[model samples]
Target: MIKNILKSALNNFQAFLVTWVVIIIVNQLFIFGACFAPYCLLAALPHTFVIAVLLNYFLNAEESNKQLNSSKIDSNSDFKYTQADNHIEDNEFEETEIPFCPKCGSKMALRTAKNGAHAGNKFWGCSKYPKCKGLLNI
Candidate 1:
């Protein structure tokens, strides 16, 4: 527990030091517009603390997301594929055999409708999708 706390503290300190230097440089360059501005230190201190805290929060959130994903994969080590995962395999087709879009002449792609009257149904859709809006029943 102590070791983990120390490691976290060390990471935070390193992040704070980097943020402080960057904030000082930015404040000197933009706000004070001088090579060395002692007065900019006042503004940089608070800005550095805020930026460091935000950076720490976002980094921790990303680490947690990775851990969550790894844990989920580990729990499913037997490798059972869900319906969503197997959808592409179940609806396999030759890309060369699909029809061209009537509206744009672009090659049509096989797509599954998620809503409307064709919900859960497969159809040939324009590769451009929203822009072309051409579709054909499979």
Candidate 2:
């Protein structure tokens, strides 16, 4: 049962990765070809938009999977709980290491807010919140 679940998850991940790679290759081809004609731009735009949407969907799925797995750790089991606690501590420590925002050199933290009109996916908002309002894709 566990193997089947893992296999399914791996297959989905592989498919997602392949799709993004192909999207990148196609984008590069379009860019290098310098095809700015209306029809060409129109064709590429929809493909790019569709890929972006699908990528966002997969990202949400991955995040939910992580959360679900974390929640499944048996707190009543000493060994399991200890391992989970250690893992959580390690993640917190790693998060502290990312000092500056890759975008604007501001501090960042894990944040939750409405996923905008996009719905479903959560994002990392700048710690500066209303003032900076910078959002990072999770």
Kindly report which residue stretches of model 1 are placed more than 4 angstroms away from their true locations once superposed: 1-12, 68-138
**For model 2, what is the error of residue 93's alpha carbon versus the real structure, in angstroms, after optimal superposition?**
50
Please name the candidate that would achieve the greatest TM-score relative to the true structure: 1
At residue 60, what lDDT does model 2 achieve?
Answer: 58
TM-score of every prediction relative to native? 0.36, 0.26
In the range 1-138, model 2's lDDT, one tens digit per residue, is 445444444556766556655775578576748655667666676667567446645555676677668776655346633344433554465433434565666887765555577576656667776677667776
lDDT of each: 0.73, 0.61
- Model 1, CA-based lDDT: 0.73
Cα error of candidate 1 at position 92, Å: 34
Top-scoring candidate (lDDT): 1
TM-score of 1: 0.36
Steric clash pairs (candidate 2): none
